[model samples]
Target: MAKPKFLIKTWGCQMNVLDSDKLAGTLMDLGYEPTPSEDEAEVILLNTCSVREGPENKVFTELGRLRPLKKNKLKVLGVVGCVAQQEKAAIFSRAPYVDLVMGPRSIMHLPELLEQARHQKALEAEFRDDSVLYPGGKISRSHPVKAFVTVMEGCSKKCAYCIVPFTRGREIYRPLESILSETREAVDSGFTEIELLGQNVNCWKDGATKGFADLLEAVSGVEGVKRLRFTTSHPRHFPLEAALLMAERPNICHYLHLPLQSGSTKILKAMRRQYDKEWYLDLVRQIRSRVPDIALSTDVIVGFPGETEEDFLETLEVVREAEYDAIFSFRYSPRPGTPAAKAEPVAGEVARERHQRLLDAQLPIQTRRLKAFAGRTIEVLVEGRSKRGTEWMGRSGDNKVVNFTSTGQPSVNTYLQVTVERAGANSLFGKAVTAKNEAPGAKCKA
Candidate 1:
C-alpha cells in the first residue's frame, strides 16, 4: 500500500510555477507523493498556459502523448490553469482521457474536483469573486532564497490582444493583511528576497486610499526582508510615488519590468494599451530620474494586426531610446476570443522578420548596459551554482544575473560583494570579493 504518486508538467509564467507549487502542496496533503517521471505516477496534471498560440498547442501535443499512458495504466489525467479555463469542457471532447479541468480561480475546489473525478469527469471553471486570494495552504516553494508572493491575481485591463481577461477573469487584489502575513512567513522561513507577483502588479490597491506604493512601503518595513521586487507593471498604473519610494527605500529592489507593447501611438491605440508612446517613455524617464541606478526591462510584441512598417520602426526606435537591460520580444499570435483575433493579421513572414529585427536592434543596447557593470562592485544574493557549475550565480538588486568564481564556496542565500571582471550581453562575469552579512547603502559602487 503505497501513497499515490503525482507528476505536474508546468508551462508559462512565474505565476503558473507558483500555482504548480500550490497544486503539489495540496496533493501532498492528500497523502500523494510527487514523482518527476510521468510513467510512475498515478496522477498527471498539465498546469498550462494559453497566453499565446504556441504554449496552448504544446499542451495538446503533450496530452496526446499522455493518451497512451492513460490507457496503459490506471492513471488520472487533468488540465489546469489558463488553458483549462479557456477551453473548459472542450478539453474533454478533444482529449476524452482528461479527468479533471479547473481554472486559476477554482484552485480551492481542487479537493472536491479530485473526489468528483474519482467517480466521473469533473470541471470547475467558475469565476468566484470572493476567492481572489489563495486560501492558506502548504506551499512547496521552488526557490530557497527568494519567495514569490502574489499581491494580486488576474488582469483588469481589456487589452485587445490579450486572452488573460477571458482565462483568468477580472482583477482581484489580495487583502493587505494576508499579503503581510505571507511576507512575514516567507522571511521567517529563511527567504530573504520577496517578489510580489500579479498580472498588472503596480495597479494593486487596498481599499480606496492605499495602493501599490503603500504596499511597497509596508513590505519594506517587514523585518529580515533583504530585497523586495514586483513584476509586469502596467505603464498606465505606475505612479511617480512608486518610483520615489524605490529611490528612498534601500530594501526595495531598483528593478521594474514595465511593458511597452508597442511604440507607435497609432499601433498602441489599436492594441488598447491605454497609454501612448510619450506617456510610457515619460514614465520611464521619471523612474530613471528618481532611481538612477535602476535596471529596466520590457516586453515587446511585433506585427500586431494592422501594424505598418513605420509602426515596427517606431518600436525599434523606442527600444533604442529606452535602453533596456533585456527585452522579451515576441511575434504576435492571435488568441481565440480576443478582439484582435477577429481582425486582419499581419503576414507570418513579415511578423517573423519584424520579431528578429526588434531583437537585433536591442542587442547592442543590452550589451552596453551589462558592460557598464564591469569594474563595479555589486551586491549579489547567491542563488546557487551556475548552469555550468564552474562558478556560483546570483542576481543584483537590479535583477542582473551575476556569475562569479570565489576562492572559497559562498553559501546560497548569502550576500556577496562581487567586482565584475567582464560582462556578456546577458550576464556579468565576476569574482566574489567578500561575503557580507549586510548589503551596503547602494547596490553598485565603482
Candidate 2:
C-alpha cells in the first residue's frame, strides 16, 4: 500500500514554524509522506498563529481557498497551532469541513488523534499535563545550515494584546540535556547555526537549566556550532545575564529582538506588558553598555485599545531613541477573547496613519544604519543566492542582510568577509573581502 502524503501550511512566528516541523516529523513517524504541493497530499494541516490579526485572517482565507480539497477525497484537514487553540469549537462552526482541531499541547498525541478523527471527530485544545516535554522527539531536519531548536513551549505572560497563553498554554521548559544532545546532533549533521526558539525565550527556567543565560552558555560550548541565537524575548522577563552572555560569547550573535509593544507607560500598563518606557530604555542602555554596536530589532504596535495621540507620540519617541536596526511595526488588531478585544480599538484610519508614521520614523534610521556599514568588513554567514540569482546573499553577525555578486556559484553555509560598497533601504550591497580559509582581502575561492 502507498503511504499517505501530508502538507503543513504554517503562518506566524518561529514557534509556529517549529511546530509545523514537529507535525511533519510526527506524520512521518506514522508512515505518512510529506508533499511539497498541497493538491497531491491526502492530509492537510494548517499550523496557525493567532498572536496578531493578520495571521488569523490568513488562516480563514487559506481554508476558504482550500475548500475544494474537501471533495477531493482528502482524508484529513486539520487546524493546529494558536488559532486552533484560540477558536476551538468556532473553527468547526465557521468551516465545517475541518476534520481535527489540535493545539500545541495536543501535538504529541497526533497519531492517536488522526486515528480517532478517522472514525469520529476530534478537538484537543485543553492544556495537557506538563510532565511530558512538549513537541517531544526529533526525527528530521530540512535545513542544511540553519536549525531552530525549541528549548521551551508556551508563554506564561498573558499580555492583554496577545492570545499566546490561550493558545500555547503555560510555559514549560524542555530538559537542558535534551537541548544539548540536539545541538550536538545538528553539529554532527554539519549545521553551523542553532537558533533557540521560545515565545519568551529569556524566561526559560527548567530545573536542569535554571536560566536562559545558562542555556546559552552551555550551547555555546557545543563544538562545531559557529553561531548561536534566540528569539522573541519579552522586556519584562529578559534576564540581565542573557545580555551579558551575548557580550561574552563570540558565537552568540550580537542581536536582540525585544518587543516593546507600546511606548506609552499608560498604554503599556493597559497592555500588562509589565515594563514601562523608562524600564525599557534603561534596559536598552544596559545592553548597549555591554555591546555598544549590537544590532537591535523590535516589534511595535502603533495603536492599541484606548491609545491616544499622545501615546502614539510616546511610542515614536521610544523608536527614535532606540534607533533599532529594524522594526516589525503593526496596527493594533483586536483579537477574540483577549481583554483588549473588548476594549474599543483606535480608529482604523488613525491606526493605519500611526502605523505608517512609525514605519516612516524608522526608515531614515535604518537607511543610515545600513549606510554606516559601507567600507567596513564584516563576516557574513552565506545563505544562498539573492532573489535575482545574480548575486549571493547572507547575513552579518549583526544580522544585517548583505548581497553581493561572486565570481562563481556561491557556496551556502560558509562564511565570508564582505566590505560594504553601498546600501539599500534594508540591506547592504557589498563585495568580497575574504572567503572561508582565506586571509583578509584574499581572493575568494570560487
Candidate 3:
C-alpha cells in the first residue's frame, strides 16, 4: 500500500496551531506524509474556529468545494477545533461528505478515526468536559526554536457574546509536572522559546498548589529555556501576582495580550466581561508600575449591538490612553446561538466606519510610542531573512518585528544586537551593531 498523505488547514488561535502540529505528528508516526495540496492528500482536515461568522461559513464552503475530490477517492474529510465542537452534527448534516468531526481534545485519536473514515464511516468525537489528555510523543513542531505549550484548556466564562464556553467547554489546567517535563523536553529538542497558551492564561489553576505565577517560575528555572511568553489573558482573571512574576523574571518577555472587547462599562457588562473601565485601567496602571517597559497588545470589538455614539467615543478614549503596541481590532459579527446574535445589529456602513475610525485613532499613538526604540541597540532573535536580501527579520523581546542587515548569514533563534536605523508603521528597520556570536546552550536554527 502507498503511504498516506495529509493536509491540514488551520483557522483559529495559537492553541489550534499547536493542535495542528500534534495532529500532523500523529499522522506522520502512523506512516503518513504531509502534502502541500489537499487535492493529492488521502486526508484533508479543517482545523477550524467559530469565533466569527465569516470563518464559520468558509468551513462549509470549503467542504463543498472539496466534494468533487472525494467522489471516488478514499479521501477522508475531517473538521476539528471550536467549530467542530460547536456545530457537531449540524456540520455533517450540512456536508455529509465530511468523514470525521473531531474537537480540539479529540485529535489524539485522529489516526484511528482516519482508518474508520477510510472504511466508509462517519463519526463525531468531542469531549464534553475539555479535559482529555493525549500522549505527548507525536508532535511534529512547525517551528524548531519556538514551541507553544498548552497550560490550560477551555474557558468557563460564559461571556454573553462568546460561544467559546459552549464550544470549548469549561477551563481545566494541565498538570504542572506534565508542563515542566514538556518544557524540559522541548528545550532538549532545540526549542529556546516556550509560550504558555490558554483561553484565559492568568486563570490557570493546577490543583490547589499552582497558578500562572507558580507555573512561570517553574518554567523559568528549566536549564535551556531562554525566553518565556503567554497569550490571551482575561481581564477578569489578570492577577497582580502574574504581573509581579513577569517583573521579577528576566526570562519572561515584557509583554501581555489582554483583550478589551469594548471600552464602555455598559457595553462591557452587556458582553459579560465582568470587569469595568475603571478596573481595566487600574490593572494597566498596576502592570506599568511594575514593568514600565512592557508592550501591551489587545483585542477590540467595535459597533457591538446597542453600542451608542458615546460608547464608540469611549472606545476611542481608551485606545488613545492605552496606546497599545499593536491592536487586533474587529467589527462585531454575530454568531448564531450567541447572545449578541439575537440583538439588532448596528448598520453595516456604521460598523465599517467605526472600525476604520478605531484604526485611524490608534495608528498615530503606536507610531509615537514606537519612535522611542529608534537609535537604540536591542537584541533580536533571528527568525529568517526578509524578502529583500539586504535585510534579516526577527522579533524583539516585546515581540516587535525588527528588520536589519547582517554582514554574514545569521542563525535563526540566536539573539543578535542590532542598532535601529528606521521605523515603519509596525516594524523597526535596523542594521547589526555587533558581530554574530553564539550564546552557550542556545538552540540556534536556520
Candidate 4:
C-alpha cells in the first residue's frame, strides 16, 4: 500500500507552528507523506488555538466541512493544540464526526491513536501529560533556510485573560542539552536561522544548569547557525542578564518582542501580568541603554474587563514612549476558565472603538520607524521572491521586512547587503548592493 498521505492546517502562534511540524514528523515516521492539498489526504489534522473565539469557531466549521470526506471512505481526522486542550468533550459532543481529538501535550501519541482509530467507532484520546517530548525529526521543515526549535512547552502564568496555563499546562522547559543538540542538527540540515519558540521563553528554567540565557549561550556556540531569535517573552521574565546575553551575542538578533498586555497598573494587576507600566518602561530603557539601535516589538490588548479611556491611553502612552518597530494589537475576548472571563464584560462597541484608536495611534509610529531605515545599508537574510517578482524579500536583524530587486536571482538563505531606498508602512524597498561574506556587524552590548 502507498504511504498514508496527510494534510495539516495550523492556526495560532509560533509554538503551534512548531507543533504542526512535529505532528508532520510523527505522521512521516508512521510512513506518511505530506500532501499539499487537503482533499487528497487520507489523514487530515487541524492544529488549533483557543486564544480567541474566532479561531475556535473556524476550526469547528472546517471539521464540519470535512465530515463528508470521512463518511464516504476510510479517513482519519485529528484535532490537536490549545482548543483540544480546552474543549475536548465539548468538541467531541458538538462534532462527533471527528475521529480523534487530542490535546497539545498528547500529540506525540498520534501514531498510537491512529492505530486505535482504525478499529474503534470513534476515538477520543486526551491525555494530560505535558512532560513527554517527541523524538526529533518526524517531518522536515518546508523552508530550507529557516527552522523553528521549541525550547519550552506550556505556560505557568495563569494570566487573567489567557487560557495557556490551563490549556497547555505549566511551563516545562526542554532540557538544555536537548535544545542544543536539536539546534546543531537543524544547522546540519541546511537551516541557517533557528527561532527558539516558547509561550514564555524568558521564563525557561529546566534544571539547576539551564535557564533561557544559558540556552541562548549554548545555541549561539553551535557552528553553521547564522541567526538566532526567540519570541513571546512575558515582561515579568525580562532579566538584566538575558538582556546582556542579547547584547553580547553577534548571532542573536537585536530584536525583542516582550508583550505588554496593558499599560495601566490597574489592568495589569487585574491581568496578573506582575509587571507595571513603569517597570516595562524601565526594562525597555535598560535594553536601549545597553544596545542602542536595537529594534523592539510588542503585543497589546486594548480593552480588558473594567478598562477605561484612561487605561487605554496609558497603553498609547507606552507605545509613544517605546516607539515599537511593530505591534500585534488585540481586543479582549472572554476565554472560558480564565480568571478575567468571570469579570464584567467590556461592551463590544466600546472595545472596537478602543482598538481602532490604539491602531490609528500606532500606524504613523511604525511608518516613522521604517522611514528611519531609509538610505541605510543593512544585511538581510533573503527568504524568497515577492509576488510581483520585481523584488526579493527578507528580514533585517531587527526583524523588519525588507525587499529589493536584483539583476540575477540571489539564492535564498544567504545574506545580502541592501541599501534602503524607500519605506512603506510595513516593508522596505531597496536595491541589492553586493554579496559579501564578512560578518555584518559587531555584537551589540549584552
Candidate 5:
C-alpha cells in the first residue's frame, strides 16, 4: 500500500513557518509523506496567523476553498496556530468540516489529536506552562541553507493594538542547552546560517544567569555556524550587549529589526509600546555607535486610534532620522478584544492617506541607504537562483537581498564576495568576485 501523504499550507511570520515545519516533522514521523498537491494528501493542516485582520480573513477564505476537498475525501482537515488559538470552537462553527483545531502551544499533542480526529472532532487550544521544544525530529526546513531555531515563544508585551498575547499566550523561554543543541544539530545537517526566532526574541533568557546576548555569543561559538541572526526584537528588551556582541563576533549578522510601531511618542504611549521616541532614538544611537555600518529595518504602523496629523508627521520625522534600510509599514487594524478595538478608530481614508505618506517619506531614504553599497564588495551567503534566473540570489550579513551574477555557477549555501554594481530600494545587484575569501570593504565583522 502507498504511504499516507500530508500538506500544510502555512500563513504568517517566520515563527509560523517554523511551526508548520514542526507539524510536518511530526506527521512525517507518523509515516506520512509530505505532498505539495492538495488533491493527493490524506492530511491537510492550515497553520495560521492572527497577527492582522488581513491574514486572518485569508485563512477563512482558504478554508472555504478546502470545503469541497474535506467533503469529498477522507482527509483529516485541521486548523492550527494563532488563529486556531484565537477562534477555538468558533472555527468549528465557522467551518464545521475542520477535523482538528490546535493552538501553537498545544502542538506537542499532535499525535493524540490526529488519532482522535479520525473518529470525531479534536480540539487542543490550551496553553502549556513549559516550553515547546522539538528536541529531535526530522524538520522539513523551508530553506536549505538557513535554519530557524526558536529561542522563545509568545509575547509578554501587551501593546494595545496587538493580538499576539491572546493567541500565543505569555512568554515561555527555551532552555539554553536545548537551543545550543539544536543549533549544533542544524550546523551538522549542513545549515550554515541559523536565525534565532521568537515573538520578542531579544527578551529571551535562560533562568537568572543568561540572556539573549549570552545566547548569541554561545551560538556564534558553534563550530560550523557561518552566520547568526535573530528577529522581531522588542525595543524595551533589546540589550546594548547584543549590539556589542554583533560588532565583536565574526559570525553574528549585523542586522537588527527594531520595530518603531508609531514614531510619535504620544501614539507609542497610546499603543503601550513602553518606550517613547526619544528613548527609541537613543537606543538606535547606542547600537549605531557600536556597529556603524549595521543595517537597520523596522515595522511602522501609520494610523492608530486617536492619531492626529501632528502624530503622523512625527512618525515621518523619525523615519528620516532613523534612516532604515527597509520599512515594513502597515495601516492599523484593530483586533477584537484588544484595548484599541474598543476605542474610536481612525477613518479608513485617513489611515490610507497616512500609510501612503509614510511610505512616500521612507522610499527615498531607503533608496539612498541601499545606494551606498554600490562600488563596494560585501560578503553574501548564496541562497539560490533569483526569480529572473539569470542571476543568483543571496543575502548580505546586514540582511540585504543581494542578487549577483557569477562567472561560473557557484554552489548555493557558500559564502562569496560580491562587488555591488547597483542597488534599488528593495535589493542590491552585483557580480561575484571571489569564493570563500574576504574582500576589502566587505560588510562583515573581522
Candidate 6:
C-alpha cells in the first residue's frame, strides 16, 4: 500500500519555518510522505504567523479555500504556531473541520495529537518554558544547505503594540549544550548554515551566557558552520558587542535587521519601542562605523494611533537619513487584545498615503544601494535553479538575491562568485565567474 501523504503550508518568519520543518519531520517519522499538492494529501497543516494582522488574515483566507477539500473524505487538518496559540479554542468554532490545533511548543506532542484527533478535536496551546525539547534526529528538510535552530522562544518585552509577549510568553533559553550538539550534528549531516531563531534573539541567556553576543561567539566557534544568522532584533536588546562581533567574525553575515517602528519620538514612546529617534540614529551610526559595508534593513509601520502629519514626515526623514538597503513596510492594522486596538486609528486614506510616501522615500536609497553591487564580485550560495534553465538563484553573504546564468550545473549549496552585471530594487542579475576567478569567500562551504 502507498504511504499516506501530508502537506504543510507555512506562513511567517524563519521561526515558523523551523517549526514547520520539525512538524514535517514528526509526520514523516509516522510513515506519511509529503506531497506538494494540498489536494493530494491525507493531512494538511497551516503553520501560521500572528505577529502581524496581514499574515493572520491570509491564514484564514487559505483555510477557507482548503475547507472544501474536506467535503467528503477523512482528511486531517491542523493549525500550528503563533496563530494557533493566540486563537486557542476559538479556532475550532471558526473552522470546525480543523482536527488538531497545536502551538509551537506542542510540536513534541504532534504524533500523539494526530492520533487523538481521529475521535475528536485536539487543542494544545498552553505555554511551557521547557516544552520544546531540542529535537535531535535524522530528518528531511526543505532546504539542504541552510537550517534554523531555535536558541530560545518567547519574548519578555512588553512593547505596547506587540502581542508576541502575550502569545509566546516569557523568554526561555534552550540549554546551550543541546544547541551546540544540534548545530554540530547539523554540520555532520551536511548542512552548512545555521540560523539561531527567537522572538528577541538578542535577549537570550543560559547560565553564564547572559547575552546573544556570547552565544553567537560560542556557535561561530563550531567547525563547519559556514554562515551564521539570526533575526527580528529589537534595538534596545542589541548590545555593542553584537555589533563588534559582526565586524570581527567573517562567517557571520554582514547584515543587521534592527526594527525601527517610527522616527517620531512621540510615536515611538506611544508604541513603547524604548528607543527614541536620536538613540536609533546613534546606534546606526555606531554600527555603520564599525561595519561600514554591512547591509541594513528595517521594519516600519506607516500608521499608528495619534500619529500626525508631522510624525509621518519624521518617519520619511529617517528613511532618507538611514538609507536602508531594504525595508519591510506596512500600513498599521489594529490587532485585537492589544492596547492600541482601543485607541483611535488614523484615517485609512491618510495611512495609505503615508505608506506610499514611505515607500517613495526609500526607493532612491534602495536604488543607490543596489547599484553599489553592480560592478562588484560577491560570493553567493546557489539556492536552486531560477525559472530560466540557464539561470540559477542564490544569495550573497549579505542576503541579497542574485540570479546568474552559468555554463556549469551549479548545484545548490555550492558557493560561486557572481560579478554583478545589473541591479534592481530587490534583486541582482549577474553572470557566474569560474573557479579561477572566484572571490575569497567563494569556496563551496562543504
Off by over 4 Å in 4: 128-132, 387-389, 435-446
Per-residue lDDT of candidate 3, residues 58-92 (tens digit):
99889888888887553788999989988977998
Encode model 1's per-residue lDDT on 1-446: one tens digit a residue: 98889999899999898888788878888899998878889889999999987888898899898888876554678999899999976788898878888888877667777888877865554666644566443777777577888888889899999999888888899988999988888776777799998899888999999999999999999988889999879999998898998999999999989899999999999999999999988888889899998899999999999999999999888889888999998889899899999999999999998998888899899999999999999999888898798999999999999999998867778889999999987999999998554543222211
At residue 219, give the lDDT of candidate 2: 93
Could you give candidate 2's per-residue lDDT for residues 355-391 as a string of tens digits?
9888999999999999999999888877777877888
Query: What overall lDDT goes with each candidate model?
Result: 0.86, 0.82, 0.83, 0.82, 0.86, 0.82
Q: Between the candidate structures 5 and 6, which one is better when assessed by TM-score?
A: 5
Q: What is the lDDT of residue 73 in candidate 1?
A: 51
Find the number of clashing residue pairs for candidate 2. Answer: 0
Better of 1 and 6 by TM-score: 1
Q: What is the TM-score of each candidate against the true structure?
A: 0.95, 0.93, 0.95, 0.95, 0.96, 0.93
Q: Give the Å shift of residue 329 in candidate 3.
A: 0.4
lDDT of 5: 0.86
Residue 74 lDDT in model 6?
Answer: 34
lDDT per residue for candidate 5 within 1-446, as digits (tens), equals 88999999988988999989888888888999988888888899999988888778887898899888876554698989898998877788888888888889887778878988888865554577553587634676776578899888888989999889988898899998898899888877777789999899888889898998899999999988888999879999899999999899988988999999998899999999999999999999999999998889999987799999999998998899999999999888888889999988889999999999988898999889889999999888887788798899889999999999988776777788899999976999999997543322222221
Candidate 1 clashing pairs, residues 3+ apart or interchain? none
Off by over 4 Å in 3: 72-74, 128-132, 387-390, 440-446
Candidate 2: residue 182 Cα off by (Å): 1.2
Error of 4 at 105 (Å): 0.4
- Once fitted onto the true fold, the runs of candidate 1 whose alpha carbons sit more than 4 angstroms away are 72-74, 135-137, 435-446
Q: Distance (Å) between predicted and true CA of 301, model 3?
A: 0.3
List model 6 lDDT by residue over 1-446, tens digit each.
Answer: 98999999999888888888888888888999889887689889999988788788887788788888887443788888888888866787877778888777777777778877776765554455664464756345666568778788888887777777777778888877888888888877766777887888888888973578888898988998889988878898888898899899988899889899899999999998889999999898998988999898999998899999999989988888888989998888887888888899899999999999898889889888888899899898887776575688988989898989887777677788889999887889998886332322222332
Q: Per-residue CA lDDT of candidate 4, range 284-390, in tens?
A: 99989987878898989878999988998899999999989898999899998888988887898999998998889989999999999899999988777875776
Clash list (residue pairs), candidate 4: 25-138, 25-139, 244-446, 247-444, 247-445, 247-446
